[model samples]
Target: MVNKSKVTINDIAKAVNVTAATVSRALNNNPRISEATRKAVQKAAKELNYQPNNIAAALRHGKSHLIGVIVPRADRAFFSSVIRGIEEIANEINYKVIICQTYEDLEKEAQTIETLVNARVDGIIASISKNTIDFSHYQSAIDKGFPVVLFDRTSDQVTVNQVVIDDYYGAYEITKHLIDQGSKSIAYLTSPIKINIYKDRLRGYMDCLADHNIDYDERLVVESNLQLQDGRQSMEKLLSGQRTPDAVFSASDYGIMGALQVLKERGIRIPEDIALAGFGNEPFTSFTDPTLTTVDQLSITMGRVTAELFFDQLKGSKKKHHEPHKTMLKPGIIVRQSSLKKGLNQENSPISEEYKELP
Candidate 1:
């Protein structure tokens, strides 16, 4: 085989009649460089098939312009919105996002995080899985001085930049809304009440019930996997009980949808048989048979803010110790036909329940 020619920035610079520094800046599209020089340098670089070594550039600048986004499920509506938000900003900022889905498995989360770290990403944004208890992988990222921003389902173990919804306040407000609708015995459907968001949501539900002087009924609080099938099964179990709940406040939209389907099949009139409300104002909520009243979390905005946070950290302009930044955006409640009853319980006055307070 003939000897291979090694391409270098110097070769491109010589061809464009410019300094290597100028060629480098032009290759990176630095705004400070003149557009004419950049175009010329780029054309020469392309003609010579010059490929800038990203690994060397990263080593020199101590940045890779790559961010890792770890989530439980990328296909979920909430995660999809968040990814869109992140990708939009990242693209604008000349950055790329490497998405990693752990599938709600702790071991998989550990492996993905490690892989991202090995890739030498500039930063990371993550939403911990329900099964995650140990945070050694997270600590390792922090130890490496790599910025980590947590969003949605974050862990309480490590102090870092975070963007999240006010789960407690949102749940409290929704529960209080159910009580305002004259729902005395409202059932609370949710996943494990151990995670911070769910725990806070459950607390809000209980606090609202207490505020309304409604006795706490353990039987009314049903815990499930928050899946569609689990929702139907849990609701069926609740309906089979001695007493039926007047309303249900679910922390999951999937669960609510499943329960709603079963209730309709069983000829149970919504708002008449049971007033229902759920969280995560998914798009399908509006298209349901009787539109759902649910919590609208600006997940996309959170994702954008999280990406911004990572960018800020990567900027390296810190004066004092980087104070942990936590953003809690308030959730809006969308009230639809599912929560409104007819006849005596009919609501006449229009109440703008959707788009509530922003935390």
Candidate 2:
């Protein structure tokens, strides 16, 4: 029987007919080492099944080369796309990533942050949970000189690098599209107003209504957790009221789906009876019976920007005491059958023309 544990760099060095120092330099791809020597060492190492000691390398450099990522939910397509983007960039730079899900729970988010800190991860990237109000947990990591990059949901309480879409502008565009479709009475569906992204969307919705000289009817606004059931319940409640909205602008794609279910059950013709628009252009949005119109949050771009921000901080290019670096991406509107009441093609629609030049 072979003693697998006995395999070491020295064995590869001997096999490659080079000193251990030369082998180490070759493995590390030192510019001084010739490419031929590097390839030889690598080939020998592979043949010998030699594994580099990452823990020792980490200790020597004072960096784990591991990034911690936290999100509200891993199952959501938006969050998953962001993670893929992060992983793509992280892998390119020879770093590994650890992912954690908070399930929209504040306590879980806080605990995850603490755990990541204790694990000595080089940095952290996270989207604040809906129920999170305090940012002291994140501040603790920053206080310890660990860099943090926030994406999607964020807060002003913690000054750190952030990559986010223009939520206010995205909401404004969505509402404006409905109004252009001749939707006189539009209902607004959203989650808790305490969340910064939701608050921004709410502000945009109100502003769009006011811009079109429409009275801000407090009764038309419904606040829920933005769950599928909440969407159906909210829709039912709105229908029960004295004034029924002609359209609904939801903060989530899931909520829009729930609304669709109720509308379909009642044999309501979408766009003709009640138009619908939602945020986050999830994959399912395009596949629905009547494709749902929604906002594309540029999730993958947000993730890539987040990883870049972390690398910038690691290189000391960004000042630790300076104002937080904010990168806001422009979101695009996806026109679909669910919200097109004028029978116009998406390209020729007035709403699309207005936003065609946006980046």
- State which candidate has the highest TM-score: 1
What are the per-residue Cα lDDT tens digits for candidate 2 across 271-320?
89999999998999989989899999888888888898888788783453
The clash tally of candidate 2 reads 0
The C-alpha lDDT values of all candidates are 0.84, 0.88
Clashing pairs in 2: none
| Model 1 residue 15 lDDT score | 82
lDDT of 1 by residue, 17-96 (tens): 88999988888889999999999998877777776776677778888888899999988999999999999999997888
Which one wins on lDDT?
2
Candidates in order, TM-scores: namely: 0.87, 0.86
